[model samples]
Target: MKKHTFMLALTIVLSVVLGACSSNNSNNGAAIETNLTAKEMVDQMLSKVEQPSLMELDAATVEQLYHLNPELLEDYSIRMPMMNVKTNEIAVLKVKDVKDMTTVEDAIKARATDVQKQFETYLPDQYENAKNYKLIKKGNYFLFVIADPADQDKLVADFDTYFTEK
Candidate 1:
């Protein structure tokens, strides 16, 4: 009877310890710290793809178009298709604080929804790209990409490498 009680207590202790360790690792965002600036990171990722006439966007233009203010970001890079008819865009942002993540994410989703609406009627392929875009977050950084579906996964995998390699 005493042996059974001892084993139960040990099992409970181990469970608590393991649970706490896993929680800490996840909450710490896996301690992702990259030496590259946001612009450099995005530029490198874009270089891997067969880009299609993308134009870099200034902060004011981003604010006007996406309703996401540059002031809230620690660093960022944005590129949109040169032609309004093309629905391809890439936005990579590092928020100054984790608390601002929801705000930034919400704005990006809204921008995606708006873009989908704009293209859904006139341009089928562009509309599909906008509808099936990838929006992902890692640590304090967020990446929102609307491009060829085949390229989206590669871009996300490349982004993960930045975190993992560090």
Candidate 2:
């Protein structure tokens, strides 16, 4: 009886030791390292020719302008969260000095229209979906979102118009 008990205890200790050793070996067997930064990622993405155009718009009384002329948004569609899958780049427009606008919603509408027009001109091909515009207002800034590269050339061509008209 004594001998049998000793054997059982020895077997249990050996099994526990072997299990721990195997687990440790597996944990150390593989390792991976990556070197990436936010700026670097942006640069790399911009370097690609197929990337979409991004722009920022600066304007005064942006909110008032939209309220005065909402029709200017004839060529834009609201952007949705799921649209990220189809977009290769994003353009942000910052509007300045909108003292005339009474509300944030008006400013957003105006800014979105302006940005959408610019995007439409810059990337006519990419805007084929006819519903690729997003208008977002944060504090005093309005954000215009554009996705797709099919209209990149049109976007470039329309660049000059953005400055001349606005």
Candidate 3:
């Protein structure tokens, strides 16, 4: 009787453990790591809510915005950065190393400062959105979003789900 009980408990434990693991190879699967690209994750986020107008920055635009040496972050990929000037904005960036990570972090901060200045000068309406923006750094990726922060947790989780690579 004791052996039977032990066997049943072991079976249950094994089932539970197996159930927690991921079995899919696709990016959307419930895997241990994210299979989706940064752009894919951003698109997923956009699908979840009303997306704001964000202009994807080009080489010139990015260069003007950063206004620093070009070689430092040449390998950095800023995915589909879009901003509506006053309404809302979002930036998804992936870099090669920790040093570039700091540069990206600083860039976000500087952008926030720029937004603040805009608010002070001509667009007080952007204050509410800017005050509680979401900034997330997971692995080598950096995400900055300015929107209704009510869904911030969900947004972060959505991005985080794909952090681990297959």
Candidate 4:
């Protein structure tokens, strides 16, 4: 009976310790520092991702991606986005300053809303994926993704991993 009680106590303590260790540090924490810029990180991430089905935007198209103040951005990438179809799209924007990231985040949100409405109107049956686009921000790094529903989580995780490792 003493051994059983001790074992249960040990298990409980282990569970608590493991749980605390695995908890998310997304809030109330500083952003991870990295040697590479956002553009380099995003480019490296694209090499890991398999998305031959989609088309990548050129520098000219990427230049026009900023609906807000384009001058604020240090660099940005917009990939695989077709105006009407439910195709894979991913973009990462690097702001010149931390404060500018919020503005860029807002612009991304507006773009998301616009894309959702457009896709909903044109492809009513498959608007769900576009509406559920993964949007994340870390420090001056802002990530916006709309990928194949089946591959969405893996793509987001891959990008997050790149940032995490930095």
**Better candidate number, 3 or 4, judged by TM-score:** 4
**lDDT at 105 for candidate 1?**
92
- Give the poorly placed runs of model 3, Cα more than 4 Å off: 1-33, 68-85
- How do all the candidates rank in terms of lDDT, highest first? 1, 4, 3, 2
Report the error of model 3 at residue 70, Å: 7.0
Candidate 2, residue 84: the lDDT equals 28
Per-model lDDT: 0.86, 0.39, 0.63, 0.69
Worst 10 residues of 4 by lDDT: 21-30
Q: After superposing candidate 1 on the true structure, give the runs of residues whose Cα lies further than 4 Å from its correct spot.
A: 1-29
Q: Candidate 3 vs candidate 4: which has greater lDDT?
A: 4
Between candidates 1 and 3, the TM-score winner:
1
Global local distance difference test of model 1: 0.86
Candidate 3's residue-wise lDDT over 69-104, tens digit each? Answer: 335542333433354455466656665554676777
lDDT of 2 by residue, 44-152 (tens): 3345434433332123232243443333321122222233223333332332333532344454555445545544655555444324544333322233334443444
> Number of the top candidate by TM-score?
1
Ten residues in a row with the worst lDDT in model 2?
157-166
C-alpha lDDT (0 to 100) for residue 15 of candidate 2: 100
